[model samples]
Target: LLPGDEEPEVDLGRLLQTVYERAAYDLRVRYEEEPVPPLEPPFAEWAATLLREKGYRRR
Candidate 1:
């Protein structure tokens, strides 16, 4: 789409609601009652690396 082209006005609440619904649906596809694959440590380390690379300081 060309910049400055007219676009439909958005309702932020509706947009956020749709995003939450989509995320929930995606989560259900991979969820399990039993323990699932561990992700916290890896994700945390990855996030830290990203933040550091971006020159963001941790509080």
Candidate 2:
């Protein structure tokens, strides 16, 4: 609220962009490889987990 006060220098938008881009890139790489499904939670649960990990939280 005072004059000459320096704001925070971090750019949160760019940071999240970088993170999302990396996740996308990794997903692409995984697509190129064979699908590896876990044996514990069953196929449906594993698929849901995969989607969640790739940032698909909801419709």
Candidate 3:
């Protein structure tokens, strides 16, 4: 590890989710077989608001 270097703060949930997605095939992981679910409009809006509030969500 580089001296004095530090890990940047981030949303670990999203980061782990992305990593899992990329590794799913290699790991032989399978998702649920259930039919596609409807989008929760309010949840999406709430997430957006939370991200904006976090500031790191932008860039």
Candidate 4:
């Protein structure tokens, strides 16, 4: 569910499976024996900081 939204019935198992699949695909693209150096602070921390800077508070 989003931060502010109407609640609706959803399949939890399918939702989680979709999220997991997308994350796995993204990870493969990011760390598949890349020649370039990895980001200094890593993706999750960097994303959190960027979102916070943009005034996006976590629920």
- Per-prediction TM-score: 0.31, 0.28, 0.31, 0.30
**RMSD after Cα superposition, model 3:** 11.4
What is candidate 3's CA lDDT for residue 41? Answer: 84
* Pairs in clash, predicted candidate 1: none
Candidate closest to the true structure, highest lDDT: 2
Task: Per model, state how many residue pairs clash.
Answer: 0, 0, 0, 0
Name the top TM-score candidate: 1
lDDT of 3 at 14: 100
lDDT of 2: 0.64
What is candidate 2's lDDT per residue for 1-59, written digit by digit as tens? 47899876989999988987978865654433335653455865666678668765342
For model 1, where is the 10-residue window of minimal lDDT? 29-38
1-59: candidate 1 lDDT, tens digit per residue: 59998997999999997987978864564222222555588775675566557655342
TM-score of model 4 vs. true structure: 0.30
Of the pair 2 and 4, which is ahead by lDDT? Answer: 2
**Candidates 2 and 3: which is better by lDDT?**
2
Regions of model 4 farther than 4 Å from truth: 1-7, 25-59
- Residue-level lDDT of model 3, residues 1-59, one tens digit each, is 48898977899999988987888753562222211463388865565566558652452
State the lDDT at 26 in candidate 2.
58
Order of quality (lDDT): 2, 1, 4, 3
Query: Which regions in candidate 1 have their CA more than 4 angstroms from the true location?
Result: 1-39
Worst 10 residues of 2 by lDDT: 30-39
Q: Arrange candidates by TM-score, descending.
A: 1, 3, 4, 2
